[model samples]
Target: MRKIIFICMVAATLFACKSASSTASTSTEATTLSTKLDRPTQVAIKGNWVLTNVTYPGSDYIKVNSFDLADSKCFIGSSWNFISNNNKGTMTLNSASCTAFTSPIVWSINNQGLFVLKIVNPGTKSKNVKEGYLLKVAGLTDTSFQLIDNINVGGQVKDVTYQFQRAN
Candidate 1:
């Protein structure tokens, strides 16, 4: 009876230690594993890119304030730098006809293939910013990709596609 009790206690201790070790590693590694964006996807997307165009249904009539930064048309020809290694980058408005500015952004591709982005206002940390935008990634390729944002147009949801090209 004594030997059985001792064995049971040792087994329990072993499980407890194993659970603790696993929990420690998971907490630290969770961020990377949180998304299903594989290494290849990350590699393909990490680089300098340009916003070639922003188009949507009825775009010829309605206007959109993209990211609350500027008119959707103004985002065309913008310079964007995406560094997937650190999930951070910058977007610069280069359109001469619109407000010229640049902003820091933190981003990630979530498991659902949503491009989750938080535009960090001037001097704030990404975590403190409670608002973000989610865009579906489509037609990703070595030379190009598209971010499709669902928007409300005339009380109905419509797709707004932002096309990107790999910068030279």
Candidate 2:
């Protein structure tokens, strides 16, 4: 009778442990799925986007420019398209002052969530620019996107933020 009682208790404890382990596994799976759904970066950033605004924030003051305004007319029709496939993209500018009318770009997002854009060998009319530029993604949505960068301006570190909107 004593042996039977001990066996029963041992079996009950094993069953309870198995039940708890199953619940934990299910909880972990759900959390992983939620994270994946919340961050749909590849899909969200794929589209034609036009620069809507640019801002420079300094220690003392902030300067903001709306691309639609007269002073920024040069960038009024400047746009970028992250193509359907994952690898390449394009930038087009309508301003006469721009050296290149259109440019081919190669782009990728790093694990750190920075957007890296590299202009391919530019055409003869284009000014040679450093191939790679990294922009920190501030926010991204179906219609709106924002990138932020910190750069040294006149020996002071300033933040430059760019806001973009879906062109279509």
Candidate 2: tens digits of C-alpha lDDT, residues 1-168: 999999999998988552321110110121111111113575678888997766675523643332212233345457889864544778776666644356777665554576655566656321243335556687788898887656555677666667889988
- Lowest lDDT block of 10, candidate 1: 21-30
Q: Which stretches of candidate 1 lie over 4 Å from their true place?
A: 1-39
- Kindly list the per-residue Cα lDDT of model 1 for residues 1-168, writing each as its tens digit: 999999999998988652221110110121222434455666678999999999998888898888777899999999998889888999999999998989898777765576767788987986676566777789999999999887776678888899999999
Find the candidate with the highest lDDT and give its number: 1
lDDT values, one for every candidate: 0.78, 0.57
Indicate the residue-level lDDT of 159 in model 2.
Answer: 63
Off by over 4 Å in 2: 1-39, 58-73, 96-100, 123-130
Model 1 TM-score is 0.77
